[model samples]
Every structure is written in structure tokens, then in C-alpha cells.
Target: MPTRKIRRTQLLALAVAALTVPATAALAAPVPADAAAAPTAPLAAPATTASTTTAPATAVAASPTGFLNLPTSLLPTDRAPHEISFQYRNDSAGDQSIAPQVLIESPVGGPFLVPTAVSLQVETSDGSWLPLPLGIETGTLYTNLIPAKLVLHSHHTLTEHYRLTVLSPSLGTVAPRIAFYG
Candidate 1:
């Protein structure tokens, strides 16, 4: 009975998470040794990182500067996160680093999202995470973007993470109302 209940709960959480996006191998199987699916866009080989995008503890992350507006309909919670890597050239001042912004959005019905915690991580080519300066909050659809002076260099991959919650009663009527870090 206990096992059955646990399975049901897992399925429920997975179902809710899947509502935001298609299931990826990491979230579907969690085989850490296996490589995740490449981006829909063309890309290079995956590099092993001392850091991962799955948790706040492992601050190692990738850049979000590619997409003009990243859709989060299937955005897995930062806790049981998904990883996507994309290459970026830091074309900011001196063509060395850039401070990027991430806008958090949810499915229609305008779910009230509060990014309790958020970060944009840039991973260097040699498998090391560049230090991210604190982000400044600008608006509701987005808040708290990486500061302007954080130095990021060429040939880097970027990842993003956010620990958030939906505040609308319509979005949180179910039992596990908040997403917890895995």
C-alpha cells in the first residue's frame, strides 16, 4: 500500500511537471552517466561539468542569452531540473563577458509566479563555472537578472535555474501546491 501511494504521488508530480514541457531523459530516467538530448538547434559535443543545472548547491550553469523569450510552459522546477546547454559568445564590453536577463513565464491563465530564487550560470569550456554577479529585479514577467559587470568570456555554455511557486488559487488547487528542491 505504501509503495502504491508513493508511486501515485510520483506520477502526480511528474504529470504536473510535464505540463510545462516534454519529458527529457534526465527527468524521465535520471541516468547521470548518460548524455542528455541536444538542443533543437545545432550544437557541439557535451562537456562534463564540475557543476550541474539541477540544483542550487551545484551553481555551475549555462547561459540563457540565446532565446529572445524562453517559453516555460514545461519548465521543470529547479529542484528536479532539466539541463540544456547552448554555446554563446560574450559580446559585451571588450567582447569578453555579458550580463544577461531571464524572463520567467507560465502557461496561460496568468499563473502568478514568484521566483523565490533564481540564477543564470555560465560554464567555461574547461568545465568550470564563472562567478555570477547578483541580478537586479526589473519587472513581474521577469525579475532579478544577472548584474551588468559579471565577466564571462568566449566559448562558454550557459544553463538556468529557478525555485518558484504559482500563487493563483487556480494554479495551486492541487495537493503538492509548491515545488520543492529535489
Candidate 2:
């Protein structure tokens, strides 16, 4: 397979390019109160008016986690495999949940012609990698939802490493996009 590994910068660029979220519905991580304090020299305190009401602090909007990480390049059909790692974090003040799925896009502008066999494995808590129960067989675009849900607590991060094997010679060289929703 004619494949090349994508650098971290390139992977991030590709992820940003491929994923699109609307402005209104986007969620941002709240800034810590201490970090929001501005540094100022000795200044006279302004007189507080009894009738004035303090405006509530506004929270800055941002994405707590980034796009799901997958290898930009897969190993050749005969090679053992390659390991890739990514971190998912919850920067929001509250817990966040997500379910992951695989999205395969047509390589050519035309319809997909062959079924791609993909094998995926996820790392376990014991520092061991285990194969996930996922199977895909199709010629057109499709999504294979992984049977797992991850809940990240505030200011916490979950690190994961995974290996992907694509059996379809035509698709082995193509990178698959991992999507997280809900």
C-alpha cells in the first residue's frame, strides 16, 4: 500500500479541516477564576454603588476535546501493525460523554466498489491492548459504531492507544476517520 504517516501538525490540520461545528452550538471550557484576574499596579478602589448590580462573568466558549485520533496511514496488508495514541480531555466544568464510531468515505468521487475489512484494538486499564468487537463490510459509505461510552470528569484526561488493520487492499492505504458523538 502506498501510505505515509501524517505528522502531528498535519494530523491536527486534517482533523480541523474534516470536522465542522456550528458557532452557536459549540461548547467552550470555562476559564478558572484566578486565571481571569488581571494584573494591575496599586490603584484606588472604585466606590461601589448600592444600586449597581455586578454583571455575571461570561464563560469563554471552546471545545474541551479534539477530534478523535486515528492513524493517518495504515500498515501494509502484510505488515504487523502500527500503534497510534491520542488523548481525550474534559476541560469543561462538568462531565462530558461520548460514543465513538468509524466513518468511511468513498476514496474516489464515485461509489465505493469493495468491502474493506477493518480490525481495531483498544488499550485496557491493565496496560494491555485488546481487540474490539467491530466488523465492517460494504461498498458504499457507512459507519461502524463502537460499543463503548466514555465519560470524562471535569479537568480530567483519558489517554488511549489503538491499532487498526484494514484488509481491503484498496482501502488499506486509505485512512479512516473516527467520529465521536453523544
What is each predicted model's overall lDDT from 0 to 1?
A: 0.28, 0.38
Q: In terms of lDDT, which candidate is strongest?
A: 2
- Where does candidate 2 stray beyond 4 Å? 1-78, 102-106, 109-116, 135-146, 172-182
Model 2, range 1-182, lDDT digits (tens) per residue?
A: 22222212232233233233333122221112232132121111111123255545443222222234344453345535556566554455554554333333344453352433555555555556565433233333222222233444555665556666555534433333222332
* Clash pairs, model 2 backbone: 28-62
Task: List, in order, the clash count of every candidate structure.
Answer: 11, 1
- TM-score, candidate number 2: 0.45
Top candidate, metric TM-score: 2
lDDT of candidate 1 over 1-182, digit per residue (tens): 01110001132233334333332211221111112132322222222224353567424223322122233344445343333332233222222322233334333465444444333333343444433222122212332222211333334323333333332212311111010010
User: For candidate 1, what is the TM-score?
Assistant: 0.30
Worst 10 residues of 1 by lDDT: 173-182
RMSD of each: 18.3, 16.3
